[model samples]
Target chain A: MTSKWFLKSTGTAAALSSLVLFLYANLRQPTLTEQMLPVHLKIFELDRTPQAHEQQAVLAVLKQQLGVTAVSFSQEGKTFSVTYCPDKITAEKLRAAASLNEAFKVSEKTFPPSPACPVPPLDEVKHKVLGVLRIF
Target chain B: MRKFVLYFVLALAVGMSLTACNDDKVLYEIDPNSLYSRLGGFDAISAVTDQFLANVAADNVINARFAATVANPARLQLLRNNLVDQICEAAGGPCRYKGLNMRAAHTGMNITEQEFNALVADLVAALNRFNVPEKEKNELLGILGPMKPDIVGR
Candidate 1:
């Protein structure tokens, strides 16, 4: 009788622990890997930065072909910066696409490094650590 | 303990892989149907504007209005930039028109209705030169139409 009770108790504990772990893992938000992953950026220059229409066209082509994340234009400087995932698209492909020039003069220009993600909140980190401890 | 560690490792790998896959899958998507997209974005705008400016330069009546620009390369470049910004902003493209307001800019110029009509014709010719779709062309002209009061005879 005692042995049966011990076995039952052990099974219940195991089941409860499993449930806790499953819930914790499944319910938790996945941490973003954007910080670790490298972002690729390329700049294109025109005789002058083309108008919005030309920018939009070039942006569309890049987004379709290269899966670019963002594009920023400096009209005064006549330049544009395209951000993308290097894993999905190559800078060369972006250059070739931007060179189409259906609207304005577009030639590839060098850009500065990609902007960094802001630091993660310390409170969020502490909460996550505490949650992990509770699981143990 | 060993089993828990193994399970945790497996879960971590699964979670990371799932996140990574989703990350790249939705990295970026451009709406294919936006006016800006249809007009071929900045490149197309630039091409059209360059051609339009060339046409404007050749038009005797309106060319005089732009005489100061023709005489100065820097002023012409600035004018080109402002024109592009204005058109793009009007067409709901992602550009901010930073030039002087139309009423202010044309206030003393006393631009006539004929000159205004001529400018529009030149614009239509430029749009046609680039083969901009009729729908988009008409939509662009409609957007520019409202500015006539602000631009004409000012």
Candidate 2:
């Protein structure tokens, strides 16, 4: 009788714990107010090393004109990387606004592959399951 | 023997619950048309960008920061295009941004929260010029609002 009671009590506890966890995980969902911020990065290739004045000139236009968030140049690589809000700028416009010399070449790159979109809120699925179970 | 039987039943219940939780994971569908289309597509976005830039240029607080582009028409146009593309991509349009991240971009600018707020006001004005509804404007701002930490106090 003791073993039977032990089995019954433990099984009840296990079932109860599982139900709580399932409800918590499945019901949680992000509210409408929570939105994701997006940023973009672009690189430019220069035919030759840009002079100090040239670099300054480009930086000024990028900052003042393009409203870029951050701009960096690599003297060693003869290239520059700029980070900006994509909502305000694109790689093409950044290259154009810089007004580089004829020798400079521009290439646009896409953002790296992000993981898949989040699964829908589990609460919706839970409701559907409960509804189906009711049909039995 | 009965103890083993109880353990097996408890374990089975736990396993089933775990499976149910996994099965319940659902991907919420987003309304793809909402942001992109409501903003009036590419042309309207471009027009809004133009207005926003003009507001930025006129605002004395942030105008000095934009002096480089304002002096030259070519540079000004490029800036406008950049702004439009940025907004478009952010709104889930076809355009892609290949620029730096916010923190890396705004690091040395010494931008204050006031300046950032001023910029946002200008953007709202631009959105208003085109009569972008309040809901859409709020949504757009919501998307950009998180960038404040990276942009301000740097």
- The runs of at least 3 residues in candidate 1 whose Cα sits more than 4 Å from the true structure, single-residue gaps closed, are A1-136, B1-31
TM-score of the A chain in candidate 1: the value is: 0.47
True-structure Cα RMSD, model 1: 18.0
- State the weakest 10-residue window (summed lDDT) of model 1 chain B: B19-28
Model 1 TM-score is 0.44
Candidates' lDDT values, in order?
0.60, 0.59
Q: What would the per-residue lDDT of candidate 2 be over residues B1-154, giving only the tens digit for each residue?
A: 7865775666666545554532211343334676967888766776566556655654555655655444333344334544665677788775554335677656767887888988999788778868899999999999989989988876
Off by over 4 Å in 2: A1-136, B1-32, B72-78
Question: What is the per-residue lDDT of model 2 for residues A17-72, given as tens digits with 9 covering 90 to 100?
Answer: 65544543444341111112233445555666667887787778777745475555
Score candidate 2 by lDDT. 0.59
Residue-level lDDT for A37 in candidate 1? 28
